[model samples]
Target chain A: MHVKKLRKNTFFSLKGVMLAGIGSLALSAGANAGTVRVTVAEYSAKTGPYFEQVAKDFEAANPGIKIQFEVVPWDNLLQKLTTDISANANADLSIIGTRWLVDFVEQGIAEPLDSYLTPEVKGRFIETFLTPSVMNGKTYGLPIAASARAMYYNKDLFQKAGISEPPKTWAELEANAKKITALGNGVYGFGLQGKEVETDVYFYYGMWSFGGDIVKDGKSGLDSKAAIEAASLYKRLIDEGATQPGVTSYAREDVQNLFKQGKVGMMMTAPFLANQIRDEAPNLKYGVAPIPKGPSGDQGTYGVTDSVIMFQNSKNKAEAFKFLDFLFQPKQRIKFTVNEGFLPVTKAEAEDKYFAENADLKVFTSLLPIARFAPVIAGWEEVADVTTSALQRIYLGNGQIEPTLKDAASKANAILKK
Target chain B: MTAKRVVAPYVLILPSFVLAALIVIWPVNELAQIASHSVNRFGQLRDFVGMANFRALLDDPNFIASLWRTGIWTLGVVGGAIICSVPVALVLNEDFYGRDLARVIVMLPWAVSLTMTAIVWRWALSGESGMLNSALIEFGIIDSNIQWLAEASTAFPMQILIGILVTIPFTVTIILGGLSSIPDDLYEAAALEGAGRWEQFRHITLPLIAPFLNIALVLNTIYVFNSFPIIWAMTQGGPANSTDILVTYLYKVGFRLGKLGEASAVSLVMFGILLIFTLIYVRLTTARGARA
Candidate 1:
C-alpha cells in the first residue's frame, strides 16, 4: 500500500513540474522574451547594486529579453569560469582577465566577436585597451575595465624627509627612499611585493622603465644590459634597507594594506589604490606620479585590462549580444567606470569630463599613454613565476644579479618553447 | 543453489567494484595516457610524444632540484612528527585529570584546516609585525626582527615546522589508539614482579606500540611527501625555489605553465617513488608480523 501511494505521488509531481515548465515557456513565448545569463566579478560590495540595476533596466527596455546575473568574488571568478567552460555550463557572457584571452582563443573556447561587433561599437573602444584581446588578427573579447601602474608617495612623509618633489629618475628615487627610511619612525620607504600575484610585475616596472623586455624575437631577454641594470637597482634598494623588511613574503594586497595604514612611504600600484585610500584612509595625504624614469629617461608601467568574453558554447548568443550592447552604452559605461574606479576602456567614457575633474584618477589617466603590457603569450604566467623567483634570489641570496636573471631568462625560454 | 550463492555475492559487491574502477583504476590509466602525450593548455591531447616528456625531466634542472628537496622535506616533517607525537601520545594515554580534554587539545590542530594553520603561522612569523618577533625582542633574545619567510635558510626550516605542526595531531591520535589497546594487566603483572615503571613501559608498552609506530611512520611519510598547501600557502616555494617540493612544483608546471604532459610525467615519477617506498615498508612490516 505504501509503495503504491509513493509511486502515485511521484508520478503526479513529475506531471505537475512538466506542466509548470511548459506553462512558463508558453507565457514567455507570448512576450517573445528569452534569458541571457551574465557573470561578473564583484569589484566591491558597494558596486553590486549597479550591475543588478543595469540588468533590470535592460530587461525593461528590451522587453523581449530577460537577464540572468551572476556576481562572483574576484578570487573565485577564474576558477568558476574555467570549470564552467570545461563542463559546457558557461554563461552567455562573462568577465575574464585579458591575460586569459590568448589561452581562450588557442583553445577555441571564446567566441570571436569581430563579426558580432558593429562598426560603431568597434570604434567606441580605446585601441590600446583592445590590444590584449586580439590574437592572430581577430578580437575575441571587449575590454570592460583597465589599469595603469603609477608611483604613489606619502606627501607628508616626503615633506618630513625634506623632499620637495617626487623622484624623477631611478637614482633619485632610491636616494629619496633612503632619506625617508632614515626618518626614525616605524615607516618603510618602499613597500615591495615579493610574493605571488604579480611579484614579477614589480620587477618589470623597473625593467620597463629601464627599457628592458623579457622576450626578444622569441628568445630570453634577461641577458640584456638593460635587464641587468633593472635587477641591480631593485637589489640595491632591498639590500640597503630602504624597503620593508619582509619583502619576500609580501603580496600586492599586503603592500596595499601597509600603504593604507600609513606605514609605507611610497608604493607603485594602480589608480585603484586611490579608491582604497579614499575608503580606508581618507585623512592620509598622497601624491601620484609616473613611475621613475631610467637613466635614459625611458619610463613605462604595466597596463592591465579585464575583458567581457562571449563563450563558444553559449546558446543565446543573440540575446547575449543585446545585453552586451546595453551594458556598453555610453550611459552605462560611464557609471561603471566611475563606480569601479577603473580606467575607462571606452572612448566615450575616456572623454567624459568626470574623469578629468577627478584629481586622483587624472594622474593615472595621464600615465596611460606610457603603459606597457606584459607579452600576451601562452605560458606567460610561468615566465612571470620564474621572474619572481629570480628577483627573490637577487634580493635574498648572495648571487650576482646578472647570472641570476640570465638563469631565469633561460628557464622562461624553455617554457615558452615548449 | 551453489552457483547462485557465488553470483549473489558478486552482485552485492558490484557497486563498490565499479566505484573503485572509476575512481582509482581509471585515473591511473588516464595518467598513463596523459604522460605519453603532449597536451595543450585547454587539456586537449595533441601529439603522441612517447617518452619525450619523461626524457625532458632528465635534463630539467628545476625538476631535479625539486625532487631532491622533496626528499628532505618528507624526512624533516615525518621525523619531526614522530618526535613530537610519541611524547604527547604517551602523556595523553596516562590516567590523569582532564585526560579527555587533553586528547582533544592534542588533536585540535588536525581538526583545523591546513590553510588556516598556514595563515596563522605566516602572520605569527611575519618579520616587521609578528608576535614572535615582538616577543623575542621584548625578552632580548634578538635585537631586531628576522624575515623568516623571506630568506631561503629560514623559510626552509619554517616550512618543515609548519608541516610538523599539521602532521603531529594525526600521528598522536594514531599512537594514542595503539597505546590504549595494550592490556593494563600486562603492566600490572610486570609491576608485581618488582619491575619499575620504566621497565614496564619499555618491555610491555614499547613492544605493543611498535606496530602503531610503524603505521604512523609509513602514513606520515606518505602524507608529508604529498603535502602541498602549507608550503604553497606560506612560501609558494619561493626565495629561489629553496622550499619547493615535488607536488608544488608539479602544480606550477601543470596549472600555471599549462604543461599537462610534463606534469603527468612528474606525477608518475612521484607516484613511482612513493610506491617503491610503501612496498619496501609493507614488506618489512609484514615480515616482522610473520616473525612476531
Candidate 2:
C-alpha cells in the first residue's frame, strides 16, 4: 500500500520533468537560427556578458548565425555528453576539455580536423595546443583557450606585511606568507586547493616546478629527489601555518571565494579569475606574477586547454566547420580570449598589441612557449585519478612519496596496458 | 470456438514483455556480457579475458574499501531512519492539532528533488559561508569552520548525516501507513491489562507491524547501498577515495577509465550481494512468523 503512493509520486515527478525539459527544447528549436552550441563550466557567468556581446558581434558580422551556449557544471558533464553522443544527439560544435580528446577519438564521436584546417590556422596556433588532439596521428579539436597557473598576490596585504613585491622564489613566498599570517585576524598568508576534487592540480604544479616528473621510461620516477622535496615542502607549509588551516579541505572555488574576500596573501590561479576579480572585487588590489622559481630556477605550472570539436554525428558539419574556421582567424581568436579572460593559442595573437596592453592577460599567453601538456594517453583520466589520490595520501603524510606514487603508477600502468 | 483464441494472452502480453526486456532485463544481461568481453570505446573488438574482470575486482584493494563504506552507508541510513521515524510516527499518530502540518515538515525532504537536496546540502556544508559552519562558529562552540566534506575520515560520516536527514520523510510515511492499520481495540485491550506502554508495544504493536517493518528496512538498505548523488555532490567520494562505495567505483571503471568489463563485473557482484541479503531477510522474517 505504501509502495503504491511512492509509485504515484515518482511517476508524477518524472512526468513533470519530461514535460518541462522537452517544452524548453521545443521552444528553443522554433526560435533558434542555426545555433552553434558550446559547453563550458557553470561559473562562466563571469564571461557571460562578453559571450552574449560576442554572439551579437558574430551575428552582425556574418549574418544568420545564432549561438546556443550550454554552461555545464564540471560534475556529470562526461555522463551527460556520452549519453547524448551515443544517441547521435550531440551539438554541432562543442567546447571540450583536452582530456576528452582521446576518448572522443576512440569512441569515434568526434571528427578529425586535418581536412578542414586552413594553412593559416595550421601554422598560426602554437603546436602545444594541438598536441592533445594528435593522438595516433589524428586531430580532433581546435584550441579555444590555454591557461597555466600563475601566482597572484594581494598587493596591499604584501605591503602591510612589509613585503615589496610578489615572491620570486619558493623560499621568499614561504617567508612572506609566514609574515602575513603573523598578522592573524582569521587571515592566512597563502591559499591553495587541497581537496580531493583537485588533487592533481595542487600536487602536480608544485612537483613540476621542482623539476619532478611522475613518469619516465614507461615507469614511475616519483622517487626522484625533486618529487620528495616537493612533497616535503607542501607538508612543511601546512605544518608551519604558512597557509590557511582549512587548506586540507579546500577546493578551487573555496580558495577563489576567500581570495575575492581578500583573505589570503598569494594564490596560484588561472586566467578566468581576472574577470571575477574585476567583477566582484575591483577594489581588491592584486598583482599577477609567474609562479615562483624552484632552487634549480625551474618556474612552471599546469596549462589546461579548452577546445571546440565537431561531433561525428553533427548534421551541420559544413556550416559548423566554416564557423570554426572563422574562429581560427587571429582577430576573432583574440576577441574570444579577451572576452573570456583566456589566453589565445595562436602565436600571432600571443604577440598582438592586445596582450601587450593588458599585462595580466599576457602572463598566460607568455607561458605557452614553455608550459607542459598533461599526458594525452587514452586512459589518462584513470591514470590522473590514481596518481592524484596517491599524491593526496602522500601530501597528508599517510605514506612516503615514492612508495605511494609507485603504487599509483602500477595501477595506472595496468589501466594503460591495453 | 475455432477462433484460435489461445494465442491472444501471449499476444496481448507481448508489447509489455518486450518493453520490460528492453528496459530492464536486456541491460542486466548486457552487463553480464560486458563483464566477460573486452571492447574499445566504439564497441570494436579488442580482447576477451573472460573472468579476468572478476579476478581484477577480487584483487582490487579499493574495492574492499568501497564495500566496507557501503556497509556503513547501509547500516547508518537504515538505523537512522528507524530512530527518527518510529518516535515521530507514534506522536503524529496521536490526535494532535496541526498533525498534517507536522507530518509535511517531517516529509519535506522527500518532496524535494534529489538534485536540489544535494545542492542545498553542499552549500550548507561548504567550508566557507556554509550556514551550519557559520552557526556553529557563531555559537563559539567551534573555533573554525568544519570542513565537513573535505577529509576522508570525516566524509563518510558527513554523508551518513545527510542520508539520515533525507531518510526521515520516506520511513515516517511508511510507518504512518503501518500505524493507521492498527485497531484501536488492540491498544484498549492492552490498557485494560496490567501492562505498561513499553511492555504493550513489544508484546502487541511490534509483532503486528514486524512484516511491514521488514519490508521498509530491506528497501531502505538496498536504496541507501546504491545511493550515488549525495556523495557525488558533497565530495565525489573524495578527500582520498575514503567515501567511495561500489556504485562510484563502477562509474569510475565504466565511464572514466573505460574499463567497461571490470565495471560490469563490479555491478554483477553488487547484484549478487543484494540478492543474497534480500533472500536472507525474507527467510528470517518468514521463519520468525512460522515459529510465532
Candidate 3:
C-alpha cells in the first residue's frame, strides 16, 4: 500500500513538473525555440523518467531546442505507428524494428539519414548494426539497441551426464544431447522451440550455422542443403528422444522456463535469458557458449536490432537529428543500453570496460561479430510463418524432411514474387 | 401529417442508422474499394488492380484449402454445440437441487473471452506440463503425453472442441429460454396419451424448439466460421497450415503478409459465402415452419 501510494504521488509530481515546463515554454513563445516531438517504445515505467531527464539535459545544453516525449508501450508502438503513417501524423522521431526498416523505406515512410549524418557519426556505429537499415546504398535508420543469440547449457546436467565440456560442433551437440537424455528422470536433453513467434529463427540458428540462409539469390533457401540438414537434426533429436516429447508445443518462453527449472540441458536463446536464470533459478548452474558449429565449421547467430527512424513527413528534421546525435553519443549510448538491457550498437559502447567486466553480456558481445539478421524484405514476417509451419510439420507430423521443406520453399518463393 | 409521421420514424432510428453507417457500411465500403487496388505493406493504396486480387485468391492453394477447413470448422462447432447443449438445456429446465447454480455453472464458459479460453487450453493441452496430460497419465489412458496443438490430426480436432466449448453455453441458454416458453399443458396432454419420454420429446419438444435451434445453428456457424483468436492464440494455423480456417488465413495475409488488398478480397469472399449460407439456412427452416 505504501509503495502504491508513493508511486501515485511520484506520478502526480511528474505531471505537475511537465505542466510547469509547458507553461514556461508557452510564456516564452517569442523566443523562437522549437520542440522536437519524440516517441519511443517505453522499455519500462522507469524509462519515462530517464527520457524526461534526457530531455531536460538536452534543452539545457541547447537553449534554442526543446524535446517533447510521447512514450508508447511496446505492444502499441507498431500499431500506433501504422495509424500515424497512414494519416501523416507521426512524431518527428521514433524507434522501430530494424526488420521493418526496408519496408518503411520502400513505402517512403522513413526518411533516409544519409544527408543528415556526418561521416564521423556514420563511422561511430558498429558496422553490423548499421547493415540492416542500409538499403540500395542509403542508410535509413540508426541502430539504438541489439540482441545476439548464444547457447545456454546446464552445467549440473552436463556433469551428471559425464560431459566435461559444452558442445562446440553439431555432431558433439547431438551426442551430448543423447547422453543427457540417457540420464533422464522427467528431464530432456534440449529445450527446442517448436512453436510460437520466431520458431523459424530457432531452426535458422542451425541453418545459418551450416552457412545457409532463408533467402539466397532473391528466392527461398528452405530447400538448400544446409537447411535440409538443419531440419534433419531436429527430426533426429525428436525421434531419438534427445529432445522433450511435444517439442512442437514449446515456445521460446516455454523452453526458457524448462531450462531455468533444470529440466533441459541445453537451449539456444538471446542474452536476456541470463537475467531470467539469475533471478528465477539461482541454484541452477549454467554456462553460456557460442552456438555449435555446423558440418563445414560455419558458425552464426541471429542478431536482432531496433533502430531510431525519422518519418519523411516530419517538419522538425534538424531538431530530430540533433536529438539523435545527442542520444548516440558514447556516454548517452552506454546509459541507454544499460537501462534497456540491450547489447551496445556502437563500437565505443561495445569496447567499454563496464561491458568487458560483465560476464553475462561478454559471451553475446563477443558473438556480435558473426551474428546475422533476418532479411529486411517486405512480407518477411509471413515468410517466417511459412518456415515455422514447415519446421513444425517436420517435427510433429510424419517427419518427412525434404519434401516438406521444398514445399515451404516454393510457397515462400511465391510470396516473395508478390 | 404524413410528412411528420415519416420524419418521426426517421428521427427515432436516426442514431441507429448513423451508428450502423459508421461501424458497418463505411468499413465495408472501404474494404470493397481496397479489394480493387494494389495495397502495399504499409496499407498505402497503389494503382488499381481491378479483379486481380480476387483472381489471385481463387488460384491460391492455401486460400482454397482454408475454405474447406473453414466449412468443416463451422459444421463441427455448430453440430457439436447443438448436440452438447440440448441435453444440458433439458436437464437445466428440470426442477433440481441448486438449479440456478447449475445454470450459471453451465454458462460459465460463455463468460470468459475466447482468447483467455485458448490460453487456458494451451496450458492444459501442453505435453510437457499440462493438467489434462497428468490426468490422462494417472488414469493409464496413455503411456505418454500428446502434443495436442502441434500435430494437425490433434490440433484441428482440439480447435473444434474449443470452438464447441465456447459456443455450447450460448446454445444452451438460448435453447433453455425456448424450453422455458414451452407450455406444460402439451407435455401433460402427451403424457395423458400414454406417450413415453422419447415420444413427448420427439412430438412436442423437438418441433417447438426448431426455430430456436435454427437460430442457434446460423449464429454458431457464423461465429465459428469467423473465429480468429482461439485458433491464432493456440496454434496460429501451423503444422503446414493444416488447422487454418478462412479467417486465420485472411489475418495472415492481411496483417502479416501486409497484402491488405488481397486480404480484402478474401474478406469479400467470406462475406458472400456466409451471406449465402445464412440465407439458405433461414429460408429452408422458415419454409418448413410455414409448412408445419
Q: How many residue pairs clash in all the candidates, one count each?
A: 0, 0, 0
Q: Which stretches of candidate 3 lie over 4 Å from their true place?
A: A1-80, A87-91, A115-124, A315-336, A347-354, A397-399, A413-418, B1-23, B285-292
Docking class of 1: acceptable
Over the stretch A4-30, how does candidate 3's per-residue lDDT look in tens digits? 111122233223323533433443342
Model 1 chain A scores worst on lDDT over the 10 consecutive residues at A1-10
Best candidate, TM-score: 1
lDDT value for model 2: 0.73
Higher-lDDT candidate among 1 and 2?
1
> For candidate 2, lDDT tens digit of each residue in A119-154?
876788788776766767867888877777677889
The regions of model 1 sitting more than 4 angstroms off are A1-39, A42-91, A330-339, A351-354, A413-418, B1-17
Model 1: lDDT of residue A388: 80
lDDT of 1 by residue, B1-292 (tens): 9999979999999999999999877978888888899877545678899999999887877799999999999999999999888888999888999998988887888887676677677778877777989999999999988888887689888889889888988999889889999988998889899999889878888888888999999988988899876787677677667778998888777756667789889999998998899999989988988997
Native-to-model Cα distance after best TM-score fit, residue B114 in candidate 1, in Å: 1.1
Q: What is the interface RMSD of each candidate, in Å?
A: 11.2, 5.9, 7.2
Q: Higher-DockQ candidate among 1 and 2?
A: 2
Stretches off by above 4 angstroms in model 2 are: A1-43, A46-71, A85-92, A106-109, A123-132, A135-138, A312-316, A329-335, A346-354, A413-418, B1-20, B42-45, B281-292
Instruction: Summarize candidate 3's per-residue lDDT along B101-186 as a digit string, tens digits.
Output: 99899889888766777877877887778888899999999988787876778888988998988998999989998999999999
True contacts kept of 1: 0.50
Of the two candidates 1 and 3, the one with more favorable TM-score, higher being better, is: 1
